[model samples]
Target: MNTSKRLEQALKKLYTAFHHNKLNPECCKQCAVGNILDNTDNWKYLSDSHGALELNYIGKVHQALGRKFNGYTPLELLKIERVFLNACNYKLPLHYKNEKPKNPTDKDVLFNGLNEVVKFLCYLDNISNVMDYTKLFEFENDKPKYKLVFTN
Candidate 1:
């Protein structure tokens, strides 16, 4: 299969795994998308954020693709972040250990977010090799902090 086809399959597997609460890194260990989603490995930098739909995840995608944000403007960043987070219902906290469960929303934000995320990822994957990572940020203390460039 072609790279695009393989990438799409990997993304589909991830989407299914996420819905089943089976998103552990080990499951899709051999796939590219799995490596990106794997908190314990390749894209481990992602664990700093919540789930796969967070803005942080988008930033991670940017970083992975060797792309960086346009340093002069943040308005674009705000717009993209709002859309992804809203689709993911990211403000809602996950309940663990019988913790207080928040009221559920009528909309299926997870599905919505995953759908958009997959589309975005597919786009990124298509152009994975040509991105310019150096433009992403201005350095502070020698650390590679990302500023995030939102793309169409």
Candidate 2:
């Protein structure tokens, strides 16, 4: 019902989706843990590696995924993956380290936060449409260009 719980539900669903599906690339383990712990979306880094992901990796991600789903281009799968991953990582955590909370939070705040993450996961599990967009890259001078995926 609250923000924290929502975050938790989203995260749990994300973890489940990742486990059930097969998107394999090295990820930031600590960040993933932090994401789950803090109920935040941290997957933007994977898709938007400051243009690095586009230059070096997005193609392979698309190719690998294309093989899994028929009638869908790698790009479509990519768009979905990007959105889903970002959803898994979104607005769950609003503060960085050394930042102060505007309002006081209790010791059990994180525990309650996990509830939302769980709910999100459940919702994701039930949905037939996971993500609607995949390709976040464009072309410039016949070369690869980075496109930001923002469907939130």
> Which model scores highest in lDDT?
1
Give the per-residue lDDT of model 2 (tens digit) for 29-133.
Answer: 222232332322333333444112242265556556654222223343234333333333332122244233232222233223233334334454454222323
lDDT (10s digit) by residue, model 1, range 3-60:
4644555466655656565443122232223333342233323334322334366455
Model 1's lDDT to the true fold? 0.41
For model 2, state the Cα shift of residue 46 in Å.
Answer: 1.8
Q: Count clashes in each candidate, considering only residues at least 3 apart in sequence or on different chains.
A: 3, 22
Cα lDDT listed for each candidate = 0.41, 0.36
Q: TM-score for all predictions?
A: 0.35, 0.27
Worst 10 residues of 1 by lDDT: 70-79
Name the regions of candidate 2 deviating beyond 4 angstroms: 1-28, 31-45, 49-107, 127-152
